[model samples]
Target: MGGRLGGVGTGLALGGGLSYLAPQYGMACDSFKELEVVLPNGTITTASATSNPDLFFGLRGGGGNAFGIVTRYTVQSHPIGKFYAGTLVYVLDHSQAVLDAARDFIAYNTNPKASIMATYEVLTTPDVLLNLDKFIVVFLVYDGTEPGTAFRNFTQIPHLLDTSKPNKTYTEVAEMPIPYTAELSRADNVFRIGAHRIEGAAGLQRPRELYDRYAAWAAANKGLYVYVALNLYPVARSMTDASRARGGNAMQMPDGPWLWVRYILSTPPGLLPGVYDKVQASFRAMVEATPSAPGLPLFLNEAAADQRPLSTFPTYSRLQQIKRKYDPDGFFVNRTGGWTFD
Candidate 1:
């Protein structure tokens, strides 16, 4: 779920290595049957999906610290039981019927073990008569149970809080109160966090113009940032048919069903030197007025380090010819950091 799915070695890598269940169990390098790596010049090797197999299709969803360093992996583990997870809180006046019931449950839910991660937040109110504060947080999961009619229209909305939990165990639904904060420099430290994310893949439409482009970037950067969040998750097709029966990885989805959009920002690291350039020009004008779904793919560890992620992988020219056939002379493309292969 976090740890960018093994620190971007590809599983759920969207904080930097690009993955979110790898289109459903096919990302963390398609459950690497083996690894080992080393190269750059230190040369130790081993890959799988049939031995080197194009560096095992460029390490699953490519860009996990940009290849050659793995030193052991051999994944593929699945087997648990109880399901139906938790977290559900709503308020902003039922947020447009919870964003129209998550755009009709990811465009007509068919229940592929139903899932969701909806959110919509805005905060900042010094009480000069309360300036702003809104909410709609949901983090559901239904491997199956708890009135699971594929999340009965988000459990019939009208919620102010609904701590759902029944037949749990994905490590007890990853220990509830969900807001995956992996030790952000010791929690409870005011705000000042910047996760200005922008993910596309808008299939099955209904981007709802990304919540009217984050309510016009929170009414033009309210209070210079203390909270602002947006997210939605769904990408079924049985997780891309179980990542194409495991013979295909390197994330590429557009045939159908899709949705993944993120926009997060929080401030107060002493208001980052007085609202650093109107917060990067209001998050690049709300990512140039959000809209995408053309070719899908794009999640690469939640992009924005100058956003390239193997040019949004449609196998980016066979992952740049498998990174010049395993670092021909690039040495893991000049020693580290990912999304390379130009």
Candidate 2:
């Protein structure tokens, strides 16, 4: 049940894992039964509910490198079967429609069997002719063979591509969205996230405006980035229920049925020294403009290096205490690049 639907792996403990099965089960971090890591003072130890319980608490949903380097993880396992999932790519002309559909899904969806991630991506290379670069890609997954009406809203939209199929393995479902590893690693990457509650019309409508604004910003400043994308991740009530059932996570997440809009912009190989900073600042400001809903926890894995994702956690104060206890002298705080505990 613990996997990259929210993170990559054992590191998920730090990032607060949100899996495709999060609604049915719980976050990936919630699956951890035990972990062995090298603590700040170079002592190797184990963390679990009955063992180094304090470390275990802080380690789940707490950002990494500040606590310890986890060498092994003993996680709870679940039965799995083929999934119904795929990716749908829509033309920019369908942007508003797709966004509307996504909003509707977020507002009312209660199905523990279904999961979706909507991303509007813009290719920023100057030579990429036409408006072909603009498109929206959605990842839909149903735990069973038939989704029933869970994804009706999305499937109704006019899309340019559809890859969803029945009876696919968990790994295949994860791989539906192709990984651009080389391009991602070599680029200048920047990420920012905004969490919002799924409220009435006004609250729900805000992200649509934010989406339009993001696209316009990327379009105006083309060539400065290899690509800029706006991704929408839903936090359903079922997901929260599952997380809470497992004694809650380090985030101490409040009630769910919310949204996290992830902002990602990557610059091509090189940019003039001063230009890079300015562009990044602009991107940061754009995300900050929307802000997160009060009491909501931002996803650490998707957050920017400069953002204080930990501060948004309801467990902030206690996490600070645990941070002081585990790395007393602040060696990790001084040496590593992560959220500030102070």
Candidate 3:
């Protein structure tokens, strides 16, 4: 009924979504009612709309860098039941067909009763017996109490491997071990054109050529390439609406249907400049292929030094104002790669 997934908890603690409704009903962070913070000078403060309101608004989505230090976060709780969830892995040889199927699914998928996540990746391990390349797809469907119905809908896909189960808890699904790791340094590249949200027939257009190139690159760069994952999550319209009511941020992409095309390039420790250049080239090609590419919006927490400046969106301005009010001297700063506001 009510439980917090530690993995999700760790994610939120490290600047992921914290609102109970977020993981439960796809709610946004600003929906939460309160937050508890410790000031730079060791002053304990509790904030909400009624008390310490400024700090409360600031911490909602403002990058949690300089607002003293959040030792504990008291969040609103929600009741959720059993749901359907699992991952679908595909071989590298079927990458083209899989990508095509995924595009079609997202385009014609009108069912509001299901939530699906599609990820494409190439896995390679140099331990002699573990090296392989393939396209892995993960689908998580939250079908209220009807897990069977959700599983049936997904089974329609002619997938190489389908692993759908029933009665799975939200925490179990949220904490499901995805392929990538949090600690490992990754060379990530993303290219997105048009609006954030695509509507109707337009959302169905498949980027076939893009998939081909990605697959080819992954194949050629075998062992050193490590892994690649392309994730598409429907940012529920309700989530967007809630965020707007709570004083919006720059994350307003399109409002229709959007996919997160993520390319995770992990390399061996010793393989330096050569591997880095190749990965960089792959990213460049991807961007060049896009018509109106807006570069990449680096995640503040995962961003490197050069990537830090890309985080300066309209939301950053609002976050800064809030930060100045509560953390004037910049105390609890943990912005990845030296991000600061002086």
**TM-score list, all predictions:** 0.34, 0.94, 0.73
Cα deviation of 297 in candidate 2 (Å)?
Answer: 1.5
Off by over 4 Å in 1: 1-54, 64-89, 92-110, 125-132, 137-148, 153-155, 159-226, 230-244, 247-263, 266-300, 303-325, 328-342
- For all candidates in order, the CA lDDT equals 0.61, 0.81, 0.52
* Cα lDDT of model 1 by residue, 57-130, tens digit: 77766754565777677777765578767778877667778887887777677656666778777765442343
**Can you give the lDDT of residue 301 in candidate 3?**
32
- The per-candidate count of clashes, in order, stands at 9, 1, 4
TM-score of 2: 0.94
Alpha carbon RMSD to native, model 1: 16.2
Compare candidates 1 and 3 on TM-score and give the better one: 3
Go through the candidates in order and give the C-alpha RMSD of each one to the true structure.
16.2, 2.0, 5.2
| CA deviation > 4 Å runs, candidate 2 | 5-9, 126-130, 179-185
> Of models 2 and 3, which has the larger lDDT?
2
